[model samples]
Target: MGRRGEHSKSEIECMALEAAEAIIEGEGFDALSARKVASAIGYTVGSLYFVFRNLDELIQRINGRTLDQLYAGLIEALSDCRHPQQCIYALGGGYLAFAARHPHRWRMIFEQQPRDDNLSIEIYQEKMDRLYELMEIQLKALAACPEEEVFIATRALWSGLQGVASMTIGRKPDREEEQWAQKLSRHLIGHYLAGLGTTQFNSRVNQSVGRLIDCPK
Candidate 1:
């Protein structure tokens, strides 16, 4: 048996989280257990409890990290786009690319809920709000609607994009799925923007419709 005090509690916690993430990424969350993580990190299952309250807490921690990474990826996707519409499209594409690349972890964020109400209230909401704000800013800039309308529009557009991702990015990557998702995203966003612009809002619809019409089959 290894000495208990060789690694600090913080070190043990970090090791446990890293090991657990690897397990989940490689073999879905159902396969993860405190015992497996402990064995991977050279610690006893009791050692894991010293850091996390239980497996539920551990899963929340992993989801939190995944959200952080996703936020970073979305930020990077916005770098090259100048127009608000372009930025919004970039955001959708970035979200899809991230989902496809990390399907398991991505699904975990939306599908798994933390058992701790406090943790859910504190961490999950904040990260999700940050993500919404990315799309919210673009919508606000693109449409001159009331704040209330902007809020509703953001939710509608994002929900549409989320639906596209959910329907297309299956557990296993299929090239056809990704392509169809990308097509649907651009098509939906283009038409939605066109409709919003038609309301004589302060936003210009731009060439989205033409682009959609010209899109390859």
Candidate 2:
């Protein structure tokens, strides 16, 4: 264990977050506690309290970090794809891969709730919207629909991908499980995109017919 004043408050905060994530990644979230985190970082529990309000605050910070990491993974997944449709598949693949790789941390984002009132819903929404906006851009390019339709389509597609990850991704996912997730995600995206195209085509046809019907005969 190191001396108390060796690390600054900000340094201790970063150390605590990293140590907590390592504990969760190795032993799962149930094994995490302020004592364990402090011990790992060679700090006292009181020191941790100085940096974070409580365990709830620490967990919220961890969740925020996880969101940022997940967002980076999705952006990297978009790099190789050429078309918007391909980019969406890349996003799904990237999402599932990250979930499988960090199952405990990924699950913590959805499962853990911060009890403290200091948790800002706006901050949480901003992180979530960053992830959704990636898919929204792709859907807008592919469907060329109204804003409302793009919004709904983005969520619908992500809901399907989230379901695929939730159902298939395991604590220690293997090659077969990852492949299964990829397969299901592709199938869902393929069919959903096809339906979206058809709907847009029919809408356009209806509008054209409406214009002719209103024209002088």
- Please give each candidate's TM-score: 0.88, 0.91
Task: Give the winner by TM-score.
Answer: 2
Q: Which stretches of candidate 1 lie over 4 Å from their true place?
A: 1-3, 201-217
Which clashing pairs does model 1 show?
none
Over the stretch 1-217, how does candidate 2's per-residue lDDT look in tens digits?
3457898888898999999999999999999999999999888898899899889889999999999999999999999999888999999999999999999999998889776545947347789999999999887666555677778878988999999999999888898999999999999998887776665556658765321111111
Per-residue error for 42 in candidate 2, Å, reads 0.8
Best by lDDT: 2
Q: Give lDDT tens digits, candidate 1, residues 1-217.
A: 3547998888888888889889988898888999999999888888788889888899898999999999999999999999889998999899888888888888898888887789887778888899999998887777556678888888898899999999889887677888888899999998888777654532224433322211111
TM-score of 1: 0.88
lDDT of each: 0.83, 0.86
Clash pairs detected, candidate 2: none
Model 2 quality (TM-score): 0.91
